[model samples]
Target: MITMSPASSNINSTDLDYYCTETPTVAIIWCVLGVLCACVGIPASVWLLWVLVQRQRSGTSNDIYVVNLTVMDLFYNVGTAPSMINYIAFRNHAFVLLDEILYSFSAIGRPLFMTCMCMDCFMAVVYPITYMKMKRYRYRLLSCAAVWGITPCIGTINAFIWYSPIPGALYWLLVPTIAICDLAILYTLRKPDPSGRSDVHPQKQRALQTITNSFVMTLVCYLPLMAMGPFLRLMPASDQVKFCVISLLVYIAPLLGGIIMPLLQLHSLGRLRGLLYCTRDSGSSEQPDQQL
Candidate 1:
């Protein structure tokens, strides 16, 4: 939280020292609201994950990916969401740093895993046969392990760069990569079947549309958080303003992200939109292991 005192331009002009103090009444408002949001949002996400798992015991590839994303969101909100309160408490500096670590883990890990999820689904949609032959639980789990392990290391380094007040950009290069893959998958899915037998693959079209909707929602939610990167250092403002803005941004991104995924899982697929699962045979009760 940013301190709400009068603007301090006399302090080190290079660094705002954001997050070292709590903002005024607004900080209190945001903290209470953030805690309330987390309390309400986390359990809904849990129920959503359970719904995904119950819908398929062995779980489709998409189910696994969704479960992974839910876990990341839950961890983020539960672990780091209270940092707002901690900021208000103004306890030991060490505790503050610890929360930052937790924040970094969620922030870095979510996007890293999201990029993987997008790539995994893009492959499933754009090249189903090849993806199925190679997609196994072991391989998918390993990819998830890589994301969790790698992103935090990079995040720690970037955190240091920012804290050091170094002149640098904090963009996570994965954003554009994920966007391009999604656009490609969407294009490929919408392309006409050369054999003109599109009638046979109505299920594919529905799945692709649902997946596109998910990606578009995620992209929209991320813009508020990611758009702040370019201005992290360059955005000129009072220390109080910078702190308040950053604290709000840090929590707002997660609040939207944590809520959006479960909402997508539950509401994005209503009767009007068709079931999230698709089947080749009308009478078959079982669905294939891969989903968009």
Candidate 2:
């Protein structure tokens, strides 16, 4: 009679083989996309922030939310994009502390920023008149600062907990909570605008649509990784094939989302479209219109 330990019995030989042998085509794709994303996302995010800063001087509340989103995207691209490149090039090398730190920063920042964006949307929908009345620039600055300060602190604590012997219960809890919050924002938007406004402005509708798409994209990207966590925990020595599949699925979704978001925003926001055109027409001396 042959006896196998419970742990060995649970391990999938196929999963182990897959991870060891597969070339991680997904990672390669992610690397290419990551490089391209950095090239475009970084520059565009910076320019958007600059434009928002320019707008800020004139002092409008609406621009604050957009500016905050731009800053979030900027930081995300700057901090996270290089990690993808490193992972692709080095295959998860030991000397990737910078990549790890950037990855961790982004892991926290993305959700935090998304939550802030959702809150901004909720405020706009629920209190349109008040939202209009509020001095947006100060509120925007304060809100962004709070998010930046709070998320990193919480992330550091979570990282410590993660490294300890305790199970990663907090991560599981946080993921679901963030998902639920995003869903709530979508739900609130689905409700009729309380002002009995039958007609939605085209620009406003497009903005809302862009946000809705972004939320969906984020959920799609992260949910698989969340689901796979338990499987990984239970079968650490599982076969490489299953591991590769999960890794590819987990990474590709986010990479695709990161690529699509800026494009979606450009489609929705004419100002971004105009900026792109102006940049392309570098040598043209024609005066550009101030209004998007």
Candidate 3:
């Protein structure tokens, strides 16, 4: 009589064979996208930071948040691409350890930085007085430090507990917070002044719009993982479903973030280009001050 232990069966059931025997089409696609993402994400992030350092000495509070998110994403884009290229060119010789290490950081770092951006918008719109008080670049720098400090703890949880669950928890926790903040700002914008001037302050309205856009990115990109968490992490799925889930987590999501970063800031690219060229701001003030 043959019998299988539950743990043994579970271990044996992992279809790693399918993972290794990839189709040529998938490899080519992954390689192309990986290189394109890295190409665009790396340069854009670097130039943005260069503009921050050279042009905006007294950068507004939002600039600080943008710096943090851009830096984290640069690390993510640079870190995730090489292994894929290597995988395509040299299969087993690919430095997969790079992928594992970089993915670990990007996995937590991306959303956390995004949360800080959303929270910065929340405060800027909902608590304008407090936001005004936070104008000093040094203060903003210190606050960014606090956000960056979260990486070790998240990395620890990922190392010990699980990686994907953190994003799920963050979605549940932060989505409502951001949504409430957006709604509150919209409410404030709609209310009339003492003279019955029911007009939204331009900056406040812009902030609200950016926050709303950020929420959309979060919802579209991250929410599905929350729903899939139980099945991917706990319950069993067929090989195809499992592959799709892992692919989304490891590949699609990061590429989306890299792509979406530029798109979200498409408005700012004009000002950014001006800064790059060492030219005076032709219309920086007229442009929207923040990105989703």
- Candidate closest to the true structure, highest lDDT: 1
Off by over 4 Å in 2: 1-24, 60-66, 79-85, 88-95, 127-142, 153-198, 202-207, 231-244, 272-292
lDDT of 2 by residue, 1-292 (tens): 0001111122344334422336566445556666676677777677656755765786643555456656656665775555654454554433243343344334455555665666666667667888889877687788778867864564444333323211134346555665665566566566776899888767567656756765675577566555655676565443453445445545555444444555555555566677678887874544455332
Q: CA lDDT, every prediction?
A: 0.59, 0.54, 0.56
Candidates in order, TM-scores: namely 0.72, 0.63, 0.69
Clashing pairs in 1: 2-23
Pairs of residues clashing in candidate 2: 15-239, 15-240, 15-241, 16-238, 16-239, 16-240, 17-240, 18-240, 18-241, 19-240
Greater lDDT among 1 and 2 belongs to 1
Clashes of each: 1, 10, 0
lDDT of 2 at 159: 35
Alpha-carbon runs more than 4 Å astray in model 3: 1-15, 18-28, 58-62, 90-95, 129-139, 156-164, 190-200, 231-237, 244-246, 249-251, 272-292
Summing lDDT over every window of 10 consecutive residues in candidate 1, give the lowest-scoring window. 1-10
